[model samples]
Each structure stands twice: as C-alpha cells, then as structure tokens.
Target: MVTRRWWQKLYHRSGSSTAAAASTRTISPIMYEFEHLYQMAMEEIGYAIDSQTSSYYAYDLEDAQAAVQACIQLYNQLPITDKWNPWAEALQQLQTRLDALPLPIN
Candidate 1:
C-alpha cells in the first residue's frame, strides 16, 4: 500500500471525494474581504488606465489619481504579514501612466 502525502489530499486525483471536500473548504473572512476589495481596486485602476490611453476629449486626471489612491489605501489597511507584495507592480504601472499625462497649464 502506498502512503499519500498530506498535501496531495487537497488536489483532485483518482476521482476521490475527499479531494473535492478538501478543496471546497471555506476561506477565512479576512481573506474574503481582502479579495473583494482588491478586485474593486483593480477594476478602478483598469478603468483609469483605459481612460488615459484612449483619445477621449473628457479624460479626467482626477479620476485616475483617485483610483490609485484607493488601491494605496487598501494596501495600507492590510496587515504586514498578509500583504500581497506582488500587487505593488500594478500600483507602479498605474503611477507611471498618471505621470506620463501632461499637466494642464492654468
């Protein structure tokens, strides 16, 4: 008889019901909340980037700035140990786009 590793039970293999049950385990409430907020921030960032790239006459720099600020706020709210460091790259890209926009002369 072959002994299975503990981690292997979480994956679907050999049509085992145990794998399905393990995989369906509920996520922690904190993680769920973080995921929801992160998605909203990403959508806002995506919209801002799209607006900046398009040739629309009514592009609002303030909206883009707000979107980046929202994401930063979200990042700051997370605990240090729970931080998703990879997300910093997305923030950096959005900042680059905002910086590239020309300032309006008053």
Candidate 2:
C-alpha cells in the first residue's frame, strides 16, 4: 500500500511551490505548457498502474517505468530560464526518490 509519508514527499518535491509561484507571478505560456505536459505524463503513469497493466505483464512494468524516468530526465535537463524552471529541480528530486525505492521481489 502507498504510504502518506511517501505521498507527502512526492507532493512537496514535485514543485507545488513552483506551481504556486507561477500562478502568483504570471509565469510564461511555455512554462505552463511544460507543467501541463509533466502533469499529464504523471497521470498517465498512474492510470496505467491502476489498470493493472504493469502487474499483469513484466514488459508493461518496465515500459511504464522507463517512460516516467525519461520524462523526469527531460524535465531535469531543461534550461532554467526563469522561476518556472524550478519544476526541473523538483523533477530531479522526485527522480532521486523514485530511484531509492526498493524493487519488488518476484
């Protein structure tokens, strides 16, 4: 089962602060688009897991995980042109947390 502590860390590290700043400071359209894409990718990963595709097939799990990792890597690599780019930093933190999680045993 998912733990509250994990969720809390994820929420904080995934740039809730950056999003708030963006709303309060009139962030650019391009930054907003990046945020939207990041959110969509996260939602897709959740949906895939919820649908049991990952558990029913080993390849599905690997593919989904790889997709998420790729997105996170891309976000972390984006140039920090403005305050909105803090999302990239946040993505890096999230990726580190995910990497630290223990793998499930077969």
Candidate 3:
C-alpha cells in the first residue's frame, strides 16, 4: 500500500489524472479578472502590434494595456509557470508599441 502526496503526482510513475493536477496557490478575483483581461488583450494586441492594422481599435489597446499592467502586478506575486508566461509576455510586450493612441480600426 502507498500513500502519495499531491506533489508526488506530477512525477510519479503512475498514470493517474491527479498527476496533471497543479499545486497552485489560491488567487483572488484580481488574478481571474486579470487573466480574462489579458486574454482579451491578446486578441486586440495582434492587430496593433504586428500589422498596426485597422482591425484593432485605440480603446481596445488602452483598455487592454491598463488590464495588462494590473495583471502583471497580480501575477508578480505568483510563480511564473508555463501556464502564465506566454500570455504574460505578450501583454508585457504589448506596451512597446510606439503609438498607444486610440485609432479607429475599420
């Protein structure tokens, strides 16, 4: 008989769904909202970052940037896992644009 802790699950030799479970710290609503906002930004930042196309609007960039800043503040408290890094990097870089002014994307 064996009793394994949750941390053991990630690297155990068994094929249990518990191995896929994450040992994440509980987060406040801010983290949830920040992730939601960052996801929204990913959609909008694409238009402004690469193409500077009219598909993304100024209001969208502004709103998303604000959200990203807030997201970073909250995310900073947690361990930077693979789950958060990708979008976190995108949102972090979204501010590098030369122009953050609102534009009316057609």
Candidate 4:
C-alpha cells in the first residue's frame, strides 16, 4: 500500500472546492536529496576507490558503505514516474560501486 506523507497531505489540502487539483513537485528539492546523498558517499568512498588516494586508508569504510545503502533505499522508495527516470539513472553508478565493496570486517 502506498502511504501518504504529511507534506503530501498538506499539499492536497486546499480551500477551493474543486475536489482535487493537480500539482507538480519542483525538481530542486528532489535533486537536492539525491545530490546530498551522492556527495556524502563520494566524500567517504571516492578517495578509497580513486588510485591517487587508495593508500590513504581509513576505518570509516563501513560508514561510507552504509551511506550508499541509504541512497539505494531512498531510490527504491521513490516513485518510479516518468519525470524521475533521469535521477534514477544518475544513481545507478553509485549503487554499482557500493555493491562491489568487500564486506566489513567483524
């Protein structure tokens, strides 16, 4: 079942008694979240994969992996509409790299 968010409820509320009005969600905020997640994972994982900084190892590798997982979850939860196709495609690279990481040490 598709659950509605509080913002969705608020957006749907209107005094004009036309039953329901169509709405278009602006692209900036949606892109912002995706970009933010990408930047965070990139900050932590980018150096590890980049040959130039591979030697600069850190213990937070697991954290970076987790961030990527969050991104993937967010992407899955997002509605797969025509307008969202581009953003979904942009995230595929991040998902692929995140998938190939070695399992975290115990």
Task: Specify the highest-lDDT model's number.
Answer: 4
Query: Could you arrange the candidates by lDDT from highest to lowest?
Result: 4, 2, 1, 3
Across 24-48, the per-residue lDDT of candidate 4 in tens digits comes to: 3444444445555566666656644
User: How does candidate 2 fare on TM-score?
Assistant: 0.41
TM-score of candidate 3 to 2 decimals:
0.36
Per-residue C-alpha lDDT of model 3 across residues 1-106, encoded as one tens digit per residue: 0112211322353434322322244555555545544554455455445544545345445544554564566566655553456765665575554245455555
lDDT of 2 by residue, 6-85 (tens): 23434465577666867786756655555654664465345445545345333333434554565665555556764354
Model 3: which residue pairs collide?
58-102
* TM-score, per-candidate, Cα-based: 0.47, 0.41, 0.36, 0.49
In angstroms, give how far residue 12 of model 2 lies from its true place.
Answer: 29
Worst 10 residues of 3 by lDDT: 1-10
lDDT of 1 by residue, 1-106 (tens): 0112211321233556434644686755454445544454455445555665555412345544554565567667777666665766766765776676665333
In angstroms, the error of model 3 at 13 is 38
Between prediction 1 and prediction 2, which has the larger TM-score? Answer: 1
Query: Which portions of model 4 miss their true places by more than 4 Å?
Result: 1-31, 50-58, 100-106
RMSD of 4: 11.5
Greater lDDT among 1 and 3 belongs to: 1
Better of 2 and 3 by lDDT: 2
